[model samples]
Structure formats: C-alpha cells, structure tokens
Target: MEIEVVVPGGATIGEAPTWVAAEAALYWIDIKRPALYRLDPATGAQRSWPMPSDIGAFALTADPPGAVVALRTGLFRLDFASDKLDRLAPPPFDPKLFRFNEGACDINGRFWIGVMFDPLTEASPPLKSSMHSFTLAGGLRPEPDAAELHNGMAWSADNEIFYLSHSQRQAIFAYEFDPAAGRLGAPRLFASVPKDDGLPDGAAIDDLGGYWCALHGGGRLRRYKPSGAVDCDIALPVSQPTMCAFGGADLEDLYVTSASDQLMPEQRRREPLAGALLKLRPGVSGLARSYLVR
Candidate 1:
C-alpha cells in the first residue's frame, strides 16, 4: 500500500482518529499539544480548537452538535460553534496521579473511557488504570479490571465483543459484550505482542471482524482475526504510530496518527515522519462509530 502523508507536521502525541460521516471529515487529537483537529481529506482543509488542558480523546455528539471531550482535568462537552466547554464529570482519579487516555462511544451511545497514570507528570511507579462507561443519565461507572496503561478501545463488528489494549503489558483483551445492557463479561486474552515488537496502542475494527492495531514503536500496523490470529501486517514509516481509523467515502482509507514525544533529538532526526498523520488504502471497510449520547 502507498502511504501518504496527509498532514506533514507531526503532532506531539497524535491519537484518537475518528471519522465523522455527516461532515465527511476526520477528527483527531494531539495529546501533548492538547488540541483537537478536523481534517478534510479531499480538499486538504483543516481547522483546530485549542484545548484548555491535555486532551485524551473525544466523541462527537449529535444533540449538542459538538463533542464530549476527555481532558486531563475531566470530561466536558464542547460546543463546536461557540467553542464553549461545559463540565460533564470530574476526573475519577486524582488528576495529579492519573489522567484520561483512550476512549470511544459504544453502539448504545455510551462513552467508554480509560484512565492511565501520567508518567510524564509523575515519577513514581505507575498506578493501575481503570475503565469507565458514561451516559447522560447514569454518569460515569467504573469497570472492575485495571491496567497500567490503557490504549486501544473498540467493539467488534457485531457489537458482541469489546476490545481493549493494555499498552504497558503489550496485550489486547476481548470481552463478551451486551449491547442492550452495556455490560461486559470476563475478559479473555485476545492478542499479545512480543517485547521486541511494539506495544499495541490504538485500534479500529473492520466490517469483517478484523482488528487493525497500530504497534507503537514497532513501525507497523497489524490486523488480527476474531480468533486471535494475525491476519495482515503493514509496515509504517513512523516508529510511533499511536492510532488508526478508517475514513473516506467508502471507509476503506486507513488514517494513522503517530507520536513525536519522548524521543531523543537523535531519534527525532532519524524519524522525520514520527508525528505525521498518515493515510493508506487497507482494502477493507470499517464499521461506523457511534456518537456520544447526550
């Protein structure tokens, strides 16, 4: 596949690529830079909103016509037009020790977010990160399991399984999901990466139950079958690919976000494309992501 550099300048920690079908634009965030960006693939037009604090992830909301943003401070609703932010919920953990990281909305429109210990801000041993589900009425509900660093978050094409990755542990887990009830069963080992290989960072699910995962620091994107077997592996130019999402008129174009943070000056010199937004045709369509409820 031919990899295209859609956005040349690298983001500090580029992540959470989400496709908005209605606008035909791709939305993403730069965590370290703390900004939200919208890119028009066809016209190469772009717009950005400066965030108040480190932004981990965001999901579009139909009713408010903006987004539910996950920031280091807490969760808030951002009105796209007014550029105003309204508090949705406070950070569950101490903001100094932990911060929100990866997140997305489920099929029922509930937002599922993960919290991770901020190594950049704290030097102590990392605390176990937790996952939470949020709704307009029910608010944030914490899940039982915890990981050192939570990253990948996606649902199977059928919505019968939930996929989550523990980047520090180099593992991706699968859980039986009940879309009607918004409940998760005990997690099973879905996939794991070797220590030499890159940790699984963020992921997207194709229509055929294939999970496309970006191997941060590995310089590759790997696709796995629903049965936990490797399907396809595509090499990437950047060594720190943080996330991938499917976009385009047919949803076959794969957009990847990479990170330029935490690299030494020499390393940065070696990786010119380290933080660029990349695109390629993966030859498979992806499922539409659900918008945040409320």
Candidate 2:
C-alpha cells in the first residue's frame, strides 16, 4: 500500500500520533523539537506549541480544554489554550538518570506512562526503564517489572488483552488485562522482532485484533496476528519510523510518525522525509482511544 505525506511539516522525533474525532485533527509530539502540534489533515493547517521542558508523551484528556502530559520533570495537565501547566505528579525517580517516554490511556480511563534511561554522557552500562499509571483520583503509581526500553502499548478491543514492547529486548509481550480495574496479569512473550525487522517503538490495535507496530530503525510498519504471527508488513521511505496510530474519520487511516534524531547527516540528506507525518488506508478500522478521566 502507498502512503502519502499527510503533514509535510518536518518533526525531529515524531513520537505519539493520535486522532481527535470532535476536532477533526491529529495531535502528536516531536520529542527532539520538544513541542506539540495540531494538524488539520484535510486542510493541512498546522499549529505548533512549545513545551517548557522535554515532553516525552501525552494523551488527550476527557476534559476538552486540557491534555495529560508526561514531561522530564513529571506529569502535568496542559491547558492547550492558555499554555498553562498544572503539575499533577512529580517524577517518581530522579530526573538525572531517567525521563518519561511512551504513554497511552487504558480502557478504564487511566493513563499508563513509561520512562526511559537518560544519561548525561555516553555510557555503556546496562540501563533499565519503568512504567506507571495515573488518574486524578488515584494519583501516579508504578507498574510491575522494570523494562530496558519501554515503548509499545495497546489494549485489545474486548479489553481482555494487553500488549507491551521493550525496544532493547526486541520482544513484544502479552498479558491478561482486567479492563474494569485497569490491571495486568503475568506476561508471556508474544512475539520477537527479527534483527532485520528493526526495534518496535509504538503500536496500536485494530478492531480485527491486528496489532500495528512501527519499526524504529528498519523503516517499516507491521501488522501482527493476534496469534503472534506476522500478518502484514509495509515499507516506508524513512529509516526510522518511530510510532503509529489509527486516525481519520472512520479510524481506518493509519498515521505514522518518524525520527530524524539518530540519522547521520548523509542519511538525513538521503531520506528527506525522515521526520514526516505519513498516512495510509490499511483497510481495517481501529478502536477509539480511551479517554483519560481527569
């Protein structure tokens, strides 16, 4: 399938891409640029907002005027209009060694976020990351099992299955999910990406039970069967397709985000579209995003 550039405005590290049905716009973050954007898909009208600190992840909240965001400092609620931030939770770990990364809202209206190792200089020591969940009533709490590079996150349509990926581990894990309570059981290895397939960064689940993942360094997107088999693979022009989400009117259009942060000068020159917002029709609709209940 062919993918066209949706919003040509280049991003440094385009990470989380999500659809807003009411606004008819796509929202995503450029981690390297350390900013947020709202793109009108049909009109190509783009609006960018700079963040006060390094923003790792964000999700549209149940409240129309705000969004829950994970920043290097901690979790905060941003008023999109006023650009004011209300600190909801402080960083659980020391900011010197860790920073927030991937995040998504669960079926129960809770936001699940993950953190990654961030060293000041080049270090060869083994590093690990952690995950957490947040709700206005419950506050922020940790998730079980520290990860090497916590990345992909998704829940099944039936709300009984959960998917998580650790980039350094090169494997995606599956767990029994309790949607009513937003809890996860013991996990088992569901599938592992081959060396040639690239590391998994972010992912989403379709209504048909297919898991769509962006291959960070391999420049591809893959749809995996619920049984842990590779069902479909689509190539992209960029070498580092970071994350993807299902958007558009019917949620059948797949939107992909890429990265140019790790690209060398030559690679950047070769792949001019490295950090672009891409779109395609995957022929399968996706489940609507779960709102973060205040």
Per-model TM values vs. the true structure: 0.97, 0.96
Residue 73, model 2: lDDT of 86
Model 2 per-residue lDDT tens digits across residues 9-109:
36888989978888888999988678888899888898877887778888776565778888888888888788888898999877777888888888777
Model 2: clashing residue pairs? none
Against the hidden true structure, what lDDT does model 2 obtain?
0.85
List candidate 1 stretches off by more than 4 Å: none
Using TM-score, give the best candidate's number: 1
lDDT score, candidate 1, position 236: 94
What's the lDDT for all of these models? 0.89, 0.85
CA lDDT, candidate 2, residue 276: 89
Clashing pairs in 1: 10-275
lDDT tens per residue, model 1, 188-229: 999989978798999999999999999998999999998999
What stretches of model 2 exceed 4 Å from their correct place? none
